[model samples]
Target: MSALGAVQPAEAAGGTRAERGDRESLFRPLSAEDGEQLPAEIESLCMNCFQNGVTRLLLTRIPFFKEIIVSSFSCDSCCWSNTEIQSAGRVQEQGVRYRLAVTSRQDMDRQVVKTDCATATIPELDFEIPPFTQRGVLTTVEGIIDRAIAGLEQDQPIRRATDEGVAQKIEEFIGRLRQLKEAQSPFTLVIDDPSGNSFVENPRAPQRDDALVVTRYRRSPQQAAALGLQGEELEEPAEPAEDLHNEVLQFNTNCPECNAPAHTNMKLVQIPHFKEVIIMATNCESCGHRTNEVKSGGAIEPQGTRITLRITDPSDMTRDVLKSETCSVEIPELEFELGMGALGGKFTTLEGLLKDVRDLVERNPFTLGDSSAPDRTQKLQEFIGKLQEIIEGQRTAHFVMDDPAGNSYLQNVFAPEQDPEMQVQHYERTFQQNEDLGLNDMKTEGYEEETGSR
Candidate 1:
């Protein structure tokens, strides 16, 4: 520090040259520090951070790094020999670090700007690399093509010639192949294209030797001959003869001779008081012989007659007698009345008249007179007594004297006993007779008569 002593005399008069040197040494550059230093690990970490940060900055400015390498080449004396010396000099001048840095920064700025624009318009390049223009790119492409060809040969032959035309031809061929495959085994294989369209194709078609052809069933020649028909001819069946006598026979006749035709005469015959009858007589016109073929009998008897009687209700004088012409009963001293509408005239009958009168009396017993009324009861009793005497006289003539007509009349009178009015009249008459004849007198008379007769 002899040089220090000579130079620092003006400012370091207060300290020795050595002290000043020590103080100055404390303010020296960090690189001059010996023991006061960062650790090697920390230095290495700092260096890495700086380097990575710089790399990130360069990468951020140069967006082309994200894109696939489209081209790469180097200019050298050997490669650009035709260039003049002046251009060479300019290129050499551009090789300086400052120049390179400036040029590289400008390129990075341009790439970042273009990358922003390209990213939005690069949809076609979504899964594809850029077109290669580098020197060795052709060799890479050739290798890729070879690999593709090898894969296709190993798998299956290319059905179509070129990639662009392959899709359309494959589609048409696949359509036909699918039909064939479906006809054979009902199985199908579908292939899908990158554009999300799909088609079915039959790979099995190439393996098959023959195609299938659909056909309709046909009879064999031998079968046709066995069935008594020509192999190629079809015949219609003959119609059957019409039958004239299939229905049921309304009338039957016997032909006198084998060749003689049958004839029948039908007639409508009516018997008095009987239903009309249909008679069919079959005759052989040639032989003049006849026989009864059909005779439809009727339910009505030819000699029978129908008589009806009607008794009107006492309360309804306008009510006519109910008549039934279907019954057979003859009554004497009765009038014949014609019925209205379709009903024919009917003659009165004894049983029908009696039954009707009995029904009428039974239905209206009060019309005869009420036995419970004092005056009417006496009158009814007197009338019933007279009627009893008349009935007894008829019965005496019939049962005791054997008078046939009287017996019949007595039977008719007694038959009315079934009627309620007639029964009450008989009871009242008997009661009155018993009252008129004293029980003792009747007893004495009966005793005297018995004694005299004995």
Candidate 2:
């Protein structure tokens, strides 16, 4: 049976709601069979015939993706059928963009999960499939080309009879699209999903795919508004609230793990003689997940900050560390490096950050699948062992953090006097670094006149 057909409702397992709630809701194995049961259907008017038809719905979870409701409509009178997939999960914390190089016929056969909110762009042809233009689908890359061809051909006959010029241009475009499907030349397929639910198949799974690059980015305010995630922004006040900096302020938020309602506590903290910062902590009672984040309370510094610490003593792990979301971490001894935004913002000790890094690598889905190689697994094991040894003070390593925004901090044991083992340097940020931080696009100096003219 197909992946969609083999799935049954969560109730099939015969568990109480409370019992199932203990685990991730609606999370169950999708590898088994339950095809004997008929799918739930509802009577609906079919668009093809305007006649009464049946719409079948199935709730199934994709292997990599969360729960999704797959629906299919059939019209007996018109012999028409339509299938659609809708995400059943909550919005993710970050948007995902996938860039894939399609160079061969095998690449064309790769499966893709295109969510309704994803935009597929082909830079080579200057063609784009905008969001909401097509229903979400579980199909191969070739199938997408075929669908585009069918859409273009659907109205060609009418256009040809009246507007031959337009029809001719469309025909040429269709020919080019057909050539793309044949994989005659190398091209790029970009899927940008604001909902972070879309996916393109990776032929090399457990290992990194050289031809595919995946990036997660924070959505713009406009994009967040489009996704119905924009919250009310508090306006700055001329006067500060009484004791606001000293008190922990609480606010309601959804849990990232389970999307359950939770509370986040925020507090303003001053790092003695250094700078003020805002610390936020969230705890989800339902999932027992906790997270702490720190944001720089002051204005952006003129230069970037880089801190390097030599970890020689076990007490070094106990020192407080603030790793901003824009910080990149590295350990030269192990040849290990972590890029910016890998762990988001953190307000924790050195040991805690190292533990989080170890957990992130160990729990990565790519390292556990059938595509995982024995050699790769062994290497990861060795790397993880080294990290554990460092955490346990069995070995020495150099820890480096580079923050282009100059917001990260590492507590110094000898505060009044600089520590011999730690080195802090402030340097001008490069052009590319400013661009990555969105500083290049900011026009703070001339914004008054520009806004008035607009």
* Highest lDDT scorer: 2
Clashing pairs in 2: none
lDDT of 1 by residue, 1-454 (tens): 1222233332223233454355433322212224542321111111322321110000000010110111112223223211000000000100100000111111222111111001111121121112111111111112322322333344233444446466565455444433332333232111111111111111111111121111112344543443344444544623322431232223444443222466665555442322333445556655454444223233322122222222222321221222222222221222211111112111223333434433332332222222123453354344334334333332111111111111011112224244222111111223432332222234534777889899
- In candidate 1, stretches whose alpha carbon ends up further than 4 angstroms from where it belongs are 1-259, 297-454
Tens-digit lDDT track of model 2 for 1-454: 1333444333333233364474333433232244432456888888877999888876655543455666888999999999877665556778999899999999999878888889999999999999989999878889888988999999999999999999999999999999999999889999999889887866543234678877788788878888887892444633456897778888888777555688999888888756888889999887576888888888778899999999999999999999888898988887787777767888889999999989877764335544345676677778889999999999999999999999899999998898999999999999988987889988889889998999
State the C-alpha lDDT per candidate: 0.25, 0.79
Local lDDT at 367 for model 2: 51
lDDT of candidate model 1 versus the reference: 0.25
- Clashing pairs in model 1, backbone N/Cα/C closer than 3 A: none
Scored by TM-score, the top model is 2
